[model samples]
Target: MDRHDELAARFEARRGRLRAIAHRMLGSARDADDAVQEAWLRLSRAGGAGIGNLTAWLTTVVSRVCLDMLRARTAHPEEPYGDDLPERAAGAGPEEEAVLADSVGLALLVVLETPSPAERVAVVLHDLFGVPFDRVAAITDRSLPAAKKLASRARHKVRGTPAVPAAEQDRHREVVEAFLAAARGGDLDALLGLLAEDVVRRADPATLPPGVAAELRGARAVAEGTVLLRERARFAAPALVDGRVGLVVAPRGQLRYVLRVTVEGDRVTAYEVVAGPARLRGLKLAVLDVPAADWAPDAPEGSPSSW
Candidate 1:
């Protein structure tokens, strides 16, 4: 085979391994693919003859690509893509690592998200992937001991104790349930008690009534507005939105909007009512449990299932 084709073959041979690494570094399978492709582009441009270890060279390239992506992500929080959502995946991609990581449940993933990019790299590489701290330090541009410290701190955040992941998910679930109950009952005090004083609620323009503001700030405003939606909550059901506890509002089993939330400690810091068709379709949504009343009997010809 010609030189280009030979290098391509070598890359394909390591595709799965590279994908697994990228997935751990970047939580999204789609983003992992992007990082992998970027690695290939650079490899094609640079060639492989000069590299002594293709696998290690590619790993470092992909890791650096992922690090840049993470840094950019922090600079520009993913804009709610009501307008710019990427095309849908043609089929399942390299989601197994992402799924298995999630299978430990979202508490771990949420905790992982709190770590800085360098800390995430150190923790995921050294702790999860069994990489040596020296290499991890090379990837993160830290001293070996500094890289070890990053992983140590992240480990504490993720698992104050080994049992924390499971316990934290349960606590988060309860908080969601309580918030829903309060919203449903139009209990102002209960709603206030659940929201952080700095809680912010943002709604997609498509979800708002004409002229209603898209963003609402402060716990009091959020609570008051939530209580006003008591009637709407009648059609809401608990679900997991983007691997986190959230709610979907389906009137007669047809999804009208989704409430995606960000919780810190016991209170909600931010939430968005995503109703635009494009944005809703892009979310990784799943019904948490089959609520009997999710699709009211005798009420619909188009219910979304037992969710």
Candidate 2:
């Protein structure tokens, strides 16, 4: 790769961290993605200036971007903070099955909305992501003391909020992966077992494959339809869909569909698939580099047994 490619790769490397920062800062994945994209555009416009501390520079740029968004969001009360995991998935694009990852919980994110825009930026950057308070001050356009105070107040609220534990998040991932493995093997019983008795499958009109139901209810009905998901199932991999563990179907590097599901105990209660162009484009759907322990690696394209 040449200079441009190198810079892009480096930027991509920071995409998740930047998105995580933006997610907490803005409290909306859609808005968070918008902030990250805006930062990239600004970076590209600069023509790769020879700046030391690229990560810090990019972080500052994105923080400013999110700060502006939070201000706009405040001005327009119509755009509320985040929703539950399922609602977030329904509204979220085909990015990660678990869109939020382990960054912060939806409850805490809702609490973040209580903070002022500058306070949210300062707290998320300095406290959560560990940026120094001085740089946070620069990003928030506040004096050092003012910045510290903003973060201090936000931190107080955060301390009182409850967060989902890492272990529970891992359990969520396990159920999602089990569903994927069962789907891949066409294991009807396994599929039924993992699905709730009154499970529901909702899909965008364009996402339904031929003979597939636009909406399905009950485990048996959903499982019967799911075994037919063989073609896409083989390409499916675990992702952080709207901050909860979910699955995405991407044969190579392109996103075909995103399955955002709700899990209760070991059973999936509800889920939606987003595949329409307009919907997909709005999501954060880059190929996730999930570790091997997460799922069996995708086989080579066109190879036997690979989608």
Candidate 3:
């Protein structure tokens, strides 16, 4: 192949990895593609003669581009780029389904949106992608210690403390996951099976349909209520709501509701859906302790599995 063909071939080899970094950092597929294209443009201009490590150089360029996009997004929230995952899934063709299957979970993406641009770079580079702290520092233009601190802060925000012990938390997570699945599928019998006889569901006035009661009691009432929201439940995912196994309804990585659940003996006893902006701001958000392999780039595509 000619020199230009060789260069294009090499760039294509690393494009997926570069796009992954941008996607995690920006949480918008379109923005991720734009960042990757910008990196390619710069790489073509600079050529590979002076670069000792092409992968590292390309990563740095894409990261910098993503950081700029994030800052601009924060400054201009009016022009949001993240499309609602539920809406996309609803209308998704096979190719789109495969892409969604390969992407990070919506809940994790929502948690990532909380960090600053610098901190996000640190977390995405060091924590998620396993880049060394020194490389992360260079990417964020900070000292080693500063970069570590940023990663530390972002890590805490993304992985908040669980209220229960590890074993207990795992048990509750399974129950909550099942509950979410049942709710999403609109399986009233399954929902009733997971809920306690005296189960109570309290929701913010804003979350309920007009004239619907804010609080629902009894397994039958709560189960039916949950089934009614099967459409909204498409965006719900298991997450750490103030250090417990609960759920969050985030459409397109934007937090809308936090469900504080009380699980007892494999059944949901009660849950409160907090939707007010003030309440959501006060509650800490975190991703569940799912295996990192689930989000790996090589994970099976077209698997529309739950998060």
Candidate 4:
């Protein structure tokens, strides 16, 4: 084969790995593709001349690209999540894209957005991808010790201890999961069954329909109100909101709303739909039950059931 073809084939082999790294770092599929494409362009220009380790070289290139993109995002704090850029998978078809999007888990994406760009890069590289700390330092332009500390602080923030006891959290998670399922399916009966007689649902004004009130009371009203937004339920997923079981609406990896729910016994007594960006930033988000090891690229083959 031609030299160009040969290089393309080799890069394609590692594209999936590189794409995973960028996607997790940027928390957006389209941005990940942009980052990976940039890496390929740089490699093509350099022509693999002096790189002894193509894999490491490409990883550094992609990661540096992601770090720059993340820093740009942080600088523009008012950047809206509803950008016009269409979400795209690296090369996956529609079905594959859906699976890829779902597997990443909205919970992790929410938490990943919390850390500073440098800390995000440090932790994602060392902890998730198992890149050595020395290499992480090089990619992030930090001292070795500084790189390690960045990862440590980022990890702590990402996996803060759940506020509820293990048993209680599990119980709450079960109820919340069921509620999401019911809402997604538009099963009014099931939603009513899980809600208390006097259940209340308060939502941000930006989240409601034109005529719908900001606050809904009574189980019938709350359950009916929830079904009205079942379309959004398609993108909703169970997550830990402020150390408790809740839901996050992240359509195509962009977080839009969070459901802060309160459970009394087996029923959902109250829930507040938070859609304001300021409120979302204040939330302490963490992955529910699922550990980082499950989705980390360095995880053992069979252990990556989610990724």
Candidate models: Cα lDDT each: 0.66, 0.66, 0.77, 0.79
Error of 1 at 224 (Å): 26
List model 3 lDDT by residue over 4-88, tens digit each.
7888898898888887778777766667889999998998888777887777888889989988887886786532222223455
TM of each candidate vs. truth: 0.51, 0.49, 0.80, 0.85
How many residue pairs in model 1 have overlapping backbones? 0
Candidate 4: C-alpha lDDT: 0.79
> Which candidate ranks first by TM-score, i.e. highest?
4
- lDDT winner: 4
Assess the local accuracy of residue 50 in candidate 2 as a C-alpha lDDT between 0 and 100: 76
Q: Give me the displacement of residue 92 in model 2, in angstroms.
A: 8.8
Q: Give the Cα-based TM-score of candidate 3 against the true structure.
A: 0.80
Off by over 4 Å in 1: 79-88, 92-109, 160-307
TM-score: model 4 vs. ground truth: 0.85
Tens-digit per-residue lDDT, 1-307, candidate 2 = 8887888897887787777777666655677788899989888888678767667888889989878877876787442111112222454333353333322423234445557889888876765566787888889999999999999887665443112465776787789888877876689999988999999998876555566668999999899888875545654666555556677654322346778879888789988887775665455422222343322112112111111
Across residues 1-307, which tens digit of lDDT does each residue of candidate 1 receive?
9999999998887777677667666755667888899999999999886987676677778888888987887786542333232333466333332233222222223345457878877776665445678877898999989989999987665543221265565667678778877886688999898899999999887555566678889999999878765655544555667767777664311356778877778988888988876777677665353233421222211122211
Model 2, C-alpha of 181: deviation from truth (Å): 19
Deviation in Å, model 1, residue 91 alpha carbon: 3.6
Give the better candidate number (2 or 4) by TM-score: 4
Clashes of 4: 0
